[model samples]
Target: MNAPPATRGGSALVVIDMINTYDHPDADLLLPSVRAALPGMRRLIGRARDEEVDVIYVNDNFGRWRSHHDELLAGALRGPHADLVAPVRPDGDSLFVVKARHSIFYETPLEYLLAEYGIGHVVLCGQVTEQCVLYSALDAHIRHLRVTVPTDAVACIHPDLADAALRMMERNMAVRLADSGSTGLFG
Candidate 1:
């Protein structure tokens, strides 16, 4: 097989499904770590924005006809879990790619968005590591994007699955799993 493609320049950031559904009874298991990781993610986002690199919100639509990027942001902002995801919604210039499934690239503009932005390196952050976040990292590998995921910056409903996701990414998929401090964290 040929090498997975490379997209992006400087560095780009992709914030995954940090929606309300994953913060409560639906998938509360991952909240604490994801919550703790928020500030770091926010800082990285801020840094990315300041550097003029692209910031894409690869959000999950949750299969809503009425649901869109803002809806997802609003739901997480207004819902009971608002405190967990609010910091993620940066003010402007951030792009969004609505995803219908786990991989952000699945039936979405994710690939085009990355290519358009010339994002050659990507940092994957957001919800349940065992699911969407994990799948997207694998997809990133297939896309040939150099991937870096912060260990403490991601979480999952089940601890094992979360840990396993990181393992699979590094061992099976060859992703770079770093600590939260590696990324450019800013004001």
Candidate 2:
């Protein structure tokens, strides 16, 4: 296997689509997996912070055009599943990028931010393994950035699709698939 991102170049732990309200459709289907994955996500976040690795949260805007990071976070915290949101909440120093679509790079400043940070590799963790995570991996690959996805840190609405997506990422995009503990997120 290739060396983890931190050894290759600057790396950031990118948390995708996790700050959610759980008020949307399929949220019920998504919650169980989110709960299952929450501990791993927390561990990864803590590890990133301890290692002084940049931790960036890239989340959907929930169609609230004017909403920013704090606003979206506040809304989620007020929702029914605050327990789910609390453990993985972004710290004050965490970088936040608002995305309007599935791919984190689509119409978002993430690519530029990554460039500004000299980030050549990104370790992605969060929800919807088959959708946002999958697409973001592709976009990262196209940008010539190395990608790593921790199997335990990503939650999904559908297990079969998520498995297929993970396989596709590893096979097609050259993404490193690992458990959150072993991903060498900080290298």
Best by lDDT: 2
Q: Report the C-alpha displacement of residue 31, candidate 2, in angstroms.
A: 0.4
| Candidate 1, pairs of clashing residues | 4-144, 7-119, 7-120, 8-118, 8-119, 8-120, 9-118, 9-120
Q: Write down the TM-score for model 2.
A: 0.94
lDDT of 2 at 71: 94
For model 1, the superposed segments whose C-alpha errors exceed 4 Å read 1-8, 21-26, 183-187
Tally clashing residue pairs in candidate 2. 0
| TM-score of structure candidate 1 | 0.86
Q: Candidate 2's residue-wise lDDT over 21-75, tens digit each?
A: 8988999899999999999899989999999899999999989999999999999
